[model samples]
Target chain A: DTAVSQTPKYLVTQMGNDKSIKCEQNLGHDTMYWYKQDSKKFLKIMFSYNNKELIINETVPNRFSPKSPDKAHLNLHINSLELGDSAVYFCASSQQKTTTQETQYFGPGTRLLVL
Target chain B: DQQVKQNSPSLSVQEGRISILNCDYTNSMFDYFLWYKKYPAEGPTFLISISSIKDKNEDGRFTVFLNKSAKHLSLHIVPSQPGDSAVYFCAADDTGRRALTFGSGTRLQVQP
Candidate 1:
């Protein structure tokens, strides 16, 4: 069984369109995160949620929003997508909010292409 | 600015040899470091990690060395195998933030 799962392994949409990526974790983790990897392969954190509450919000644009329905699921919704938004989005989860040796488990990334 | 940096874009090593990858971080608040190996179209898998209190951690053939004074860390793979060929990412956990800052990955190719 997959510990972390994301839907639509690939997504292609026109610029200015809105799209969503869904993520679910079966590990019963309380903290979930979203990371974006650009073409240059620079991985950056966009958002982090702990117990359905926003904990960390990076300098990402407001067009991108994260919604956590429960502790096991966190979904990302991007509004007015731009060409620069084309990147591989990864969802990850960690058990505790603050652990020195905390390990994050990631899902197969969702490659989004904005035309 | 990038808090964590992996200067090497790519590295090549012969199978059964030793492969070392280095990473540096500017943030002193990071108390934990990890090394992840990623394959094409897949998420990164945790290979090894080290806490600030420890200088080294080892698992099987993989070892991670952390230097808090120099703000540097390294992953060493002894007898590197062909399956070890993948993009290696260095991530740091900022104390109390619970968020990880990742460095630009280094692609390692282990020639058979």
Candidate 2:
């Protein structure tokens, strides 16, 4: 079984369409994160959730929202997607530890393309 | 502004040789550094990591070196194999947060 999994490995939609990506982790981690990798291969953190609470929000657009229903699931919803939103989205999770020694496990990325 | 930077966008190395990938960061608060390897259509997998307290960490063919003073870190692979060709990303852990800052990835091509 996969430790972390994401739905819709590939998504193609119009620029104005709204889409959602689902993510789940079986690693029993308390911290979950969303990252976006652009065409330039630059990976940047979009948001982070710890124990169902929003912890870190980077300088992402307001059209992007992240929801964590429980510790095991985190979903990302993009409203009014734009051409600039086309990228590979990754979901990651890590255990809450005293030190930064905890390793983050990532799911297979979801490639989204906006026309 | 990007805190972590990977100046080299791509690298080439011959098989059975050594491959060195470099990364620099502007944030001194990052106490931990990690390297991840990613193949096409797949997520990045953790390769190796180094803590600020230690200068180096090695595992089998992979080694990570950290220079806290210079805010620089590097990943070294010995006896590089063709299978080792992949995109390598350097990440830093913000000391007080759970989020990781990643640098632009470096694609390594190990020629056989």
Candidate 3:
């Protein structure tokens, strides 16, 4: 059983296409995050949701939107894809910890290729 | 601007030796540090972490050392095995912020 999972492990599409990547966590976490690993292999935070509410939105493009229907699910929708958007996206979950540091569990990344 | 930096892009070590990976951060607000190991085609796995209050934390054969003054941290793997070969990432977080800033990963290869 996967603690965190994403659908369409591999996505190949042409530029200007619209696609969505779905993420789910079964670990009963209240916080979820989306990270993009660019060609340089730097994992940067795109968005974060806590208890199904938007909390952190980095300086990402407007085309990328994140929606959390519930605490267990967070989905990312890209309006118009571009060749520069080709990268591996990862979803992670963590139980909010204020006393000590909390560890984030990640799901198998979805490698998106835009031709 | 890259807040976190991993100077070494790749590292190689012999089996049964020690492997050290270094990371430096420019954000002084970051008080919590973590190390994550990732293999190709897989997500990063939580390895170990240390709070700014402490200088070191260890689990199994993995140990993490932090120097707040230097704004630097390092991960040490003792008796490095071939299975330990993977990309190691160093992450830093602020005291209250749950978001993490990750450094450019260092690929470690343990030769047999």
Which candidate should be chosen as best, given DockQ against the real structure?
3
DockQ of each: 0.80, 0.75, 0.82
Q: Which candidate is the best by TM-score?
A: 3
Candidate 3: misplaced stretches above 4 Å? none
lDDT of 3 by residue, B1-112 (tens): 9999999999999999999999999999998899999999999999999999999999999999999899999999998999999999999988587898999999999999
Q: What TM-score, to 2 decimal places, does chain A of model 1 have?
A: 0.96
Which has the higher TM-score value, candidate number 2 or candidate number 3?
3
Instruction: Kindly provide the TM-score obtained by chain B of candidate 2 when compared with the true chain B.
Output: 0.98
Candidates, ranked, TM-score: 3, 1, 2
Tens digit per residue, CA lDDT, model 2, A1-107: 89999999999999899999999999999989999999988888899999999989998899999999999999999999999999999999999877557788899
Task: Calculate candidate 2's fnat.
Answer: 0.74
Minimal lDDT window, size 10, model 1 chain B = B92-101
Worst 10 residues of 3 chain A by lDDT: A96-105
- For candidate 1, what is the DockQ? 0.80
lDDT of 2 by residue, B68-96 (tens): 88889999999899999999999999668
Per-residue lDDT tens digits of candidate 3, residues A2-114? 99999879999999999999999999999999999999999999999999999899989999999999999999999899999999999999997668778889999999999
User: What is the CAPRI rating of model 3's predicted complex?
Assistant: high
- Mark the regions of model 2 whose C-alpha exceeds 4 Å error after superposition: none
